[model samples]
Target: MPKIIVEVMPKADLLDPQGKAVAGALGRLGHSAITDVRIGKRFELTVEGEVTEQILADVATLADEIFSNQVIEDVTSIRVEEAQA
Candidate 1:
């Protein structure tokens, strides 16, 4: 079996309100050294039986189509890790 890891983040060109708020709060709390903070989502899926390039491609397509909002978010990265023996 293999695993698919998907990471989603706000588009680099757009402003992240949540991240800004967190950073502001941190600054107010005397953590001014923390210049920025960004939040993102991570998902891990276990794939069994079939391990093909098409399967992996489908997973990526599905992730982009459903899990992430192409308008406001972007797919940061996708990692396919083989199971440990």
Candidate 2:
């Protein structure tokens, strides 16, 4: 099987409260060197058959329309991972 992976992340111009909280926690935990953190989402679509260009296109649409909020997030990446035999 092959898997289609979609990555969504908060827009650069927007503030991520969750990310800021995590960053603050990290600093408090003595991870001061870690200056920033941004939370994102990863969606996996496992394909049972051959991967096709149309499928990829459809997945791209789904990533933008269904998986992420366009106002605050962007689809950062799309990738295919082949299963290990």
Candidate 3:
């Protein structure tokens, strides 16, 4: 089996309130060197057979249209890998 990995992240111009809250907590916890933080999402799709270009393309479409929100997030990466037995 094979798998597709997808990564999504918030638009650079948009503010992430959750990430900001985490960053503030880190600062309060004595982590001054940590300047900022941002949050993202990862999705893995396990395929039943050999990975192919068409499958990859289909997954790319899913990543852009379903996995991530185009308005608030961007599809940062899409990759194929062997599924662990």
- Expressed as tens digits, the lDDT of each residue in 1-85 for candidate 1 is 7888899999888899999999999999999899998898898888987568898798789879997999999998988888888
Error of 2 at 47 (Å): 0.8
Distance from true location, Cα of 31 in model 1, Å? 1.8
Per-residue accuracy of model 3 over 1-75 as CA lDDT, tens digit each: 787889999998999998999999999999999999999999988998898889899999998899999999999
Per-residue CA lDDT of model 2 for 6-32, tens digit only, reads 999999899999999999999999999
Q: By the lDDT metric, which is better: model 1 or model 2?
A: 2
RMSD of each predicted structure:
1.5, 0.6, 1.1
lDDT at residue 6 of model 3 (Cα atoms): 95
Supply the global lDDT for candidate 2. 0.95
Q: What's the C-alpha lDDT at position 40 in model 3?
A: 98
Q: Write down the lDDT that model 3 would get.
A: 0.92
How close is every model to the real structure, measured as TM-score? 0.86, 0.97, 0.93
Candidate 1: stretches off by over 4 Å: none
33, model 2: CA deviation in Å? 0.7
TM-score winner between candidates 2 and 3:
2
**Per model, how many backbone clashes are there?**
0, 0, 0
